[model samples]
Target: MSLGSAFQTLCGALFEDSMTLVCSAVVPESLTKKYRNRMISPRDPYSIYQLDSINSSYLLVFHFEDMPDCRTIQLTDMHNLNCTSHTGEEKNLYFGYSHRMCYNYTLDLTTELKHHCGARGYEENMQSGYYYTNHDPNPDIRSDVSGGSLLGSPTLVICLIVSLLLIALLHWKTSRL
Candidate 1:
């Protein structure tokens, strides 16, 4: 089935409150193999991942909480879900996958819309699929770098002061001699 159909299935299965959704689809075996190691297993269903299998079928698991709006849900960023406004039509909802070097996942209000509550204008690209990261993805690490210079560090300032004091002592001894 297509990604659009899978999303439809997800909309139907969603309910009130927090829930874990497992949407299955018949994708190419190659696609499933590509993400096999990252696939979510039944043992750990909380995270999002594609199921590894011998056949051309795999399951996509997602964890989200229902929003106050009808049929609207806030998907966790940990799964690499990027929601955007449907091109041309602002009322529609578009979902896609994004992969970057770091596993930084944070909810951007600009990317998420309250109108996406209903899947009425929902659309997804066929290329979109689950993304897996072997390492820990921390968003704070990247944000912490403010483009400051090493000279701004306290350790460097202390070292500079000590060096200046040593130079003054050496000069005093030479003058006395």
Candidate 2:
């Protein structure tokens, strides 16, 4: 699958800029069913999560496929959803473009991008190796993608209850001593 044309042009404009802006993407398909159920809505393809320190905020889109590199996140599109106006110009909250990546992750101005994308221009400088594939960009996509809270799980509650009971038992035993 591929992204629409409008989304691609917008991505190019944002990435071409050297300015650093903070943003994030919400990929609901990244979470497991159990964890997803704990979320407000599970498997929501359109959900967006972000924090903004700049006047611009871009939403990087991706499409998932089942292949050898099944988890590879193909850059699909970008949406200029920034609400803040700039330079005495009206904020463009309705612009988009299509883009793609052979890599597993979408690079952006966030801690996650810093961790995966190298100092080299994000789209260029692919390292040559005898045993490397585009999937190397993100070998474990599902590991940390979940937004659900662990404390909301039933197992954690059971563990908490058991711990409280054990503490109460210990208190009683100490009083008897």
Candidate 3:
């Protein structure tokens, strides 16, 4: 079977609903160059090997309503789908490598150029790996109690109570005088 057909079959079997293949291309030389000397382990969420025997590598991008199960994909020849990284609610990209002419896919979410894969049930998978590029209209703002509103801090509330007590004491003393 052609690599393209294999990918389509894999996706069809993996995802419950029909998904769209947004993009597919040969993995950029510049990107592959970065991993020339890097050691890739089977346990790693992503893998990049210097297999001179394989002439070319490809990157496949797919759009899905929900992420496919990482465990199920791990069972396939594609191996694990890096479940921790994602671009948006409905988009994911997979990095495929040629191993002895058969595609040995790896989930390369760490790459800066492409959107990462999302795994099932992992909340972190919903977050985009490219934080700098994310122009979130309603970004979450986290603040400590001290840095937040004055009424929200216990220390400030105690201080206000103490100040009020001190003022009452002073007023009572002046009225007595």
Candidate 4:
């Protein structure tokens, strides 16, 4: 049904090595290409204006070169999965064994522990709903985004009154002339 499932079937049929994982990570890269523009509004044909008078319309093309190499399972020397400390804790996960090499011995699981703890804390938020883009086609109906500047406060009211009076005065003067 899925790509992973198809891959599994193919691997089972052909290859001896067991298929492990297929993870994808995206990183932004600035790309530029030209194509035809198609943002025409059917409702208001007369309101259509040219972005560029010389150029008619163009499309932005983003090219994907190749599939990323992420099809492998790096075997680690995880001798013991379940381990315990000197003080005798309930249960411990054997992260990595200490090696007395020339390099620095920095084997701290505090980061990983904190990460898992934080993840657990966000269980409620995760259960709520999935995230979306700022420019999502169907934006949240409840949001009062407000396209332009809002007319609020006493200062704005006074300014508006003054403008109206000035306009009225100008019209009166023109009429008299």
Candidate 5:
């Protein structure tokens, strides 16, 4: 990559930030049936939850019993999903990126943390690690890429990748001259 091209990648990553509140769970067959193509309400704690800007990658270590890491749970790693829901059963959600660890209990998100999530029965799998991105559209533009989606929108990511490729190609051509 040429100088300008490299700068753009860095710049873009720095700017155009977005967020996504994704969630996962060791859901049972009963819950899985409901999750099939359904847009669940935030108050349903028994479902996969969503939150904002919590960072986690690879594994999300959920501790247990206030025992200081006595028990932990591991969650799979996926990019991220939009629909950042900071209210309801998911709020101030934390996450990890790649190699994370801990004693996480995959239980009690909906019935618990109702007050925390501003909803009554938010069954969030709060015990495991779940990273989220800052998707608030109105965040201060100058804020660093600290909060935004890694790949904001698939369409957007695709567009940016294409645009960067084009820019890099042009820069390479000019530099070659």
Candidate 6:
């Protein structure tokens, strides 16, 4: 079963106002603190906290404190979940609600919207999947070729010829010496 199901079972037993939801919300602050670094084993179903709070709009960012691969996702009107990574050292998620008195709007993470700073980064879908890292250029582009075939172009051919000629000249000079 997915994390959703485990959440349902645990929530039902723990909280009177329990509900099972996907990763589109929050895990209660209290629960998050309780299971800070606990590993969710199959035998120990309640080890992981289910973040299914659909009460407020919030932002959740997951990244290593020192790593550059910062992947952020926002959810609108979400419940709080208190779960951490298996190691409890790398994954960090934060949740906060809007305090603007006049603007009671919550931004949905699944929607295609730009940030306030004018940077365009939106979740492709409201579902969770593998995060695109800097190592993978053009994550949106997919190909079926294994190892990706390297196509030779005129520039590549010319560079190869130049490299070989330079190597031959160096070898000839060294031999004469």
Misplaced by over 4 Å in model 6 are 1-55, 58-148, 153-159
Which is the leading candidate under TM-score? 2
User: What lDDT score belongs to each candidate, Candidate 1 first?
Assistant: 0.30, 0.31, 0.32, 0.24, 0.32, 0.30
- Candidate 4 stretches with Cα past 4 Å from truth are 1-26, 30-132, 135-142, 145-159
The collision pairs in model 3 are none
Better of 1 and 6 by lDDT: 1
Lowest-scoring 10 consecutive residues by lDDT in candidate 2? 125-134
Steric collisions counted per model = 1, 8, 0, 5, 33, 14
lDDT by residue (1-177, candidate 1, tens digit) is 654445434432221122222232223344335445444332332122211221111123322211111121223333222222223221221123322121112222101211222212322211123322232244334323554755698988999999999999999999999
Task: State model 4's lDDT.
Answer: 0.24
> Candidate 1, residue 101: CA error in Å?
14
The C-alpha stretches of model 2 lying farther than 4 A from their native spots are: 1-65, 68-148
lDDT of 2 by residue, 64-105 (tens): 111112111122224332232223232223222223322223
TM-score of each: 0.23, 0.24, 0.20, 0.18, 0.19, 0.22
All-Cα superposition RMSD per candidate: 15.2, 17.4, 17.2, 25.2, 18.1, 18.0
Report the C-alpha lDDT of model 4 over 69-115, residue by residue, as the tens digit: 21222112221112122243323222222111110122122122223
Judged by lDDT against the true structure, how good is candidate 5?
0.32
lDDT of 3 by residue, 38-100 (tens): 322222233221111221222222222122222112112332232322333332233333221
List the candidate 3 regions with Cα displacement exceeding 4 Å: 1-148
Greater TM-score among 1 and 3 belongs to 1
Deviation in angstroms for 41 in model 5? 26
Worst 10 residues of 1 by lDDT: 63-72
Better of 1 and 3 by lDDT: 3
Which portions of model 1 show Cα errors greater than 4 Å?
1-147
